[model samples]
Target: MSPQRPTNPAMQRLVDFYDPAVMGKDVGGRTLAQILAWRDTRLESQHDYIQVLFPLPEGSIFNEYSPVVDEETFLYLRHDSNDGFKRAMRRALARMLSFYGFDITWDQDAAGKWVVAVDAKKGAEEDHFPRWVRRMDHNHLRITRILRSLRVLGLEDEARAFFAALCWTFDSYRRIGDGSMKFWRRAVELPLHIAPDGTEVDWLEKYEEKKEEKAEE
Candidate 1:
């Protein structure tokens, strides 16, 4: 008999869990504890981010340009529960943001809660990318773009939830093989645009065209 494929209820649950308005509320409340507990109970795995080797081989010139990770730290994050991993990530991002003293806006209601917003941002950022491995800089850039876009759209909570999903997807890919890495590369290669219907458009195509226009100019 053929081996059966595991049912991916997690994927379905994740899709349902990512309601933009709901996510926004969670972020505004800074309810990471609740979110983490929810994810743990539903997903049953603590790992929320994934790791993959850069397309370039080790020791290649590109390797030097890529980001690096502390192997032990990466392993710990990979194996820890979702809550523990999120906390660790928050601490790391807090240290990085403290260097800049940046102010993060969690929501309109949180205007007075600078400390809370910062704490939440640090946690969210860390939770989204717990391990800083090589080739993961793109992941950060993607996340930063998502957050900025959310701010522009006034969808702070949705942005938080989206970032959470992104991190979760990344983690899922890491657990899978290099095939997952290839999938991410392909996904990123495709242009992402926002449609009038509130869907993603081929924004990358527009980006390429603008670059070409600039080159011609």
Candidate 2:
């Protein structure tokens, strides 16, 4: 039987992104799985794929062609209802995490909402940690996009969990470089709530420091 296609082009592309059996392509004409299969060097060099892998409610600052997560589509992809999307999201998350020499784990609370936990990958080459954490680059912005996308797409707990991991990296990883933390803070609470440009930092316990610090070379 042929797959049931979505009437909305954006919805159809989204289905292509997170649904494995659908062979549709993102706006860039690459499937999500194809993007995921890219090596670290390609992942590092490519600028457009991040916005597609982890879309925000608003258009991407880096990639203009990015798909925005509007309210109607956002509500339709509910965590309580859509386990397949959750699984596909997990794979996407894991792909990014592993790229940065990290491993992922998941848990469920009483309500059964899935939550993500990140850890440094064990037995990684000695240089892996430094390569991922020491430099300030596009990955930092990618982190922001990932967090907000997770939240807007009905994975709030998972977003919070990922944020907690970022908090740890900011402090412990050392040399996270300048300006990354501020961008990350902005990610959790973009001007809009979960709508296009919507972000919430209400759950964060402490306010960000007014003065920023520079990481050592």
Candidate 3:
């Protein structure tokens, strides 16, 4: 069956942008695939794409033009019925990982059950990737965005799994500091409680959150 259209026009456009089958472009007139194909320098320099790729319920602080995630869009993206969209988001996550010079792979753990791990790609250390992850840079903010985005978008398992790998990497390398890692933890564990309206309640936003609860009560 074809993907269902969304009731909200802005959300409809965002959904098409994310769903590969729909092949919709963002406000910048670039397809998601095309944006992913951009070189690392371009990826680093181009700030707006990250917001488009890993949107949140709230607007981005740095990018004024970022798309805001809406209730209808959130439901459709997170619905188990749309497995394809989830897979597409996963692929997008991997691409972002690669941009940071990390590669994700599955390997058997102690019990031989397969598990996910993120490691610096072989020879990637010769370049600036390792140093970048180590530095107190804007990359951490991007990581923050994606991690939270993955969780809110219904890939919580994948987000937790990636965090486990990151934990291991931090322990083994001792590069990324404790302060930076805290953001990662908060993003994955953020309580995106679904409100009656079918969207996540941003617990961090006291004003709006209180308003919603007051209205409900």
Spell out the clash pairs found in candidate 3.
Answer: none
Each candidate: RMSD to true structure?
A: 17.4, 9.1, 6.5
lDDT of each: 0.33, 0.68, 0.75
- Residues 104-181 of candidate 2: C-alpha lDDT, one tens digit per residue: 887887999756677767755463555557657767777877887876666666677677777787787567865777
Please report how far candidate 3 places residue 148 from its true position, in Å.
0.7
TM-score of each: 0.23, 0.75, 0.79
Worst 10 residues of 3 by lDDT: 190-199
Off by over 4 Å in 1: 1-176, 193-208, 211-217
Off by over 4 Å in 3: 1-4, 106-115, 193-217
Put down candidate 1 lDDT per residue, 151-208, tens digits, no spaces: 2222334445444444454564463234334433333333233322223433224644
Q: Compared with the true structure, what per-residue lDDT tens digits does model 3 show for residues 9-78?
A: 7677788887778889988899889998898889888788999888888777798878877666766787
Best TM-score among the predictions, by candidate number: 3
Candidate 3 clash figure, as a count = 0
Ranked by lDDT, top first: 3, 2, 1
From the highest TM-score down, the ranking of the candidates is 3, 2, 1
lDDT of residue 88 for candidate 2: 82
Better of 1 and 3 by TM-score: 3
lDDT of 3 at 188: 70
